[model samples]
Target: MTYKYILPIDTKNVSLEMIGGKGKSLARMASSRMSVPSGFYLTTSAYKDFVQKNNLQKDILNLAKPEIIGRTVSFESASKHIQELINGVELSDEIVNEIKQAYGALNGQNPAVAVRSSANAEDLPDLSFAGQQDTYLNVRGEEALITAIRDCWASLWTPRAISYRHQMGIKQEVVAMAVVVQIMVPSDVSGILFTANPVTGERSEIIVNSSFGLGEAVVGGQVTPDSYVVDRKTFTVKESIIGPKAQKIISSDKQGTILQDVSEHERSQSSLSDKSLKELTSIALNIEQTFEGVPQDIEWAISHGKLWMLQSRPITNLPPQPIEVSWEPTPPAKILARRQIVENIPDPVCPLFEELYLTKGLETPAKGQSRKSFFVGGGPMFVTV
Candidate 1:
C-alpha cells in the first residue's frame, strides 16, 4: 500500500506503541473478518513530524501556563494560528503518493470518508477522552481528505479539548494525535454498546442504546433510544426499554447531517430483533476476548442488514474489584486451635459461653505464650498448660 498509513486489515499485529489500543483493536477486528469499516490510520509518526516541524513544544508550554492557575486560555487565537500553520505546510510527494495509493485501494477516486481523531492518551483504562476531539464525516476527494486530516490535527487544541487535557492531568506536550480515515457506512441504525452493564457494573450483561437514522441522536442524548440489556452468557434479551423517539439525525442529501422525526408506526417498533441482539453480543464478546479485557465501550452501525463495529474502547470509569483467591490445599489440624471454658453461672448464659468457646476455637494462637494462673470469683482457674 502506498499510503501514509495502511488500512486496518493490511496492518495486523500492530503493538500498542505503533498504534494505540483503539487503533490496534480496529485493525485486529478488521483482520478477524469482523465488520469494521474500511479505514487507514495516519500513524503516530505523522503526529510526531507535525509536532517537530511546527515547534509545538513552545506552543504547548504556553498553553500549560494558564492551566496551572486554574485559568482558561482563549484557544481561538492560538488554535487559528496553529491550524493555519498546519494547513499551509505541504506534505512530501512520497507521503502524498502513499496516501493516494491507499485511498485508491479503498475504491479510489472520490469516496466519502469519515476522518476522526484517535490519540494515544484516549481510550485507556484510567481515562477516556471520548468526544474530546473533532470528527469530520462525509469528506470527499483527496484534497478534502488532506484538509480534513489537518483539521483533525487542529481539533486536538479545541477549547473543550484543551480544558479536558488540563482536567485529565495530561501534559499537552506529550500528547500526539492520530487520524483515522474510514469509509463512511450508510447507517440505518447506529448507537453504543456496553459489554457490561454501565449502571450496575454487572459483567454478565451487555447494554445497548440504539436509535434510527444516524447515531448522533443517541450519542448527543437528544432523543431517548430503545435500550436493550442482554445476558452475555445465555445470549437472551433480559430487558428492553422502548422510548418515544420523536426525532432522528440522518445524512443530508447534499452533505453533512440533518435531523428528521420518526414515523408514528416506526417509533413504536423495535429496531433490532432478538436474534440480532444475540449476534451483536457474540461480536462484542469476540472483541472483548481479542482485547483480553473486562469490558469495552463499542460503537456500532447497521447497514443493509449487516452490523459493523465502528470503534471500541475499554470502559474506563468502572472501578476495579478485589481479586478473589481460590482455596487449594487444606491446612494442618494443628494450625487450628480450640478453646473451652465452663462456668456454672446461669442456664441461659451457658449457651452464650458455649458459643463464645466455639468462636474462640477458630482463632490461632501467637507464637509465644506463658502459662499463668488466674482466680475467678475466688476460684482457681487454669489458664493453660
Candidate 2:
C-alpha cells in the first residue's frame, strides 16, 4: 500500500523513514502485549511536505548557519524572518484529512486526544532530546487536533529547542518531527518510574514516584510525591516515602488541563498498595527486558487500578556502576580494619583495590630466615629464595 503522511497499526515493519523513533517504538510496543494507549502516527513525510511546500528549506538552511561575531543585525532579522515564515504556513488538506481519519478510527467523533511530538532524534540511547518539543493534552474534535499538530510542529523551533539542537550539534533543518496522537487517559494518579534506582544505579531495585491526578505536578516539580522502592527479584516493597502534596493537575470539563488543591485526607496517603507496587514493578521490568536495556525515565498512569506505561527513555544523567571484585580469605581482625577503611573512603573506589586492601594483612612471610642460594642480578648471592 502506498501511504502518505500518517500510518495505522497494521504498518508494523515501517522503518524510521515512515515514522520517527517515538512513533516506531510505540508501534512496536503496541504490537506486543504491552498496554500502550491506542493511537496513530503523523509520519515525518508530512512534516517534510509542509517544509517543502512553504519554501522553508533555504530559509531553514540560512537560519542554521553559525552567526559571525559582532553581527547583531544579521541574527535578529534572520530569526524573526524564520518565525514569521513558519507562522504564515497553513495545514494542507491532505494532512488534515489523514489526521481526522486517524482520530476517528481511535476515538470516533468528539473524542479527546493527547497530541504529542515525536521528533526524529528523541528517545535515543547515547543522548535523549526529551521535552525539547511540545505536547497538547485533552484536545477534543478535529479543529483542536489540527491546531495542536501545527503547534507541535512550531514547538520544534522554540528558542529552548533551537538552543538544545545547536548544543547537541544537530542541524535544525536536518531534523524532522512526527506527531503521536494518543487516546487521552483520564488518570486518577500518575507519576514516573525508574527500572533502576536513579540515585544508586541498583539494577535489582525499581523506584516509583507518584501523586494524585495527572503527572504534570510531579514532572514540573510543583509538588513533592510519594516514592516507593521495590526489589525487582523478590517483588518486595523495600521502602515508601509519602510527601506533602499541595496541588494536582487534571483534565477539565471546559477543555485542556487545570490545577486544583488536593484534599487533606488524600495528601499523605500512599498512591499504590503493596500488591499494586509489585505488579507495577513487574511491568517496568518487562518493558526493560523488551527494550533490552535499563530505562532511565518512565512515565506511567494508573486508571481504574490498572497501570499503563505512557513513555520511557534512558536516564542520561546517571553515572556508571562500580564493578564487583572477589576477595580471598582474610583474618577477622584485618577484615574489621578493612571495613573501617572502606567506611572512611566516601568516594566510589575501585572494587579490586578494595579487595586487595582488605586482604593485605593476611599474607605472612616464612617464620625462620635461612641462608639460601639465590640469584641476584644474574650472579650467585647468599639470600633467602
lDDT per residue for candidate 1 within 57-79, as digits (tens), equals 57655744432234745555555
Span of ten consecutive residues with least summed lDDT in model 2: 374-383
C-alpha TM-scores of all predictions: 0.76, 0.81
Give the backbone clash total of model 2: 1
- CA lDDT, candidate 2, residue 159: 60
Cα error of candidate 1 at position 6, Å: 4.1
Find the candidate with the highest TM-score and give its number.
2
The lDDT per prediction is 0.72, 0.74
Root-mean-square deviation (CA) per prediction? 10.4, 7.7
For all candidates, the clash counts are 2, 1
lDDT tens digits by residue: candidate 2, 1-385: 3447777743577776566667767776667677887777898889889999988888876775445558532344445566677778897888888887777777667777888888887777776667767888999988998989888877777666666667788867778889888888888888998888888777777889989888877887888999988888898888889988878999999569998999999987887777777777888888787777766578888888877778777777765664676543322212212233334544444546535552232233357753222212211111222
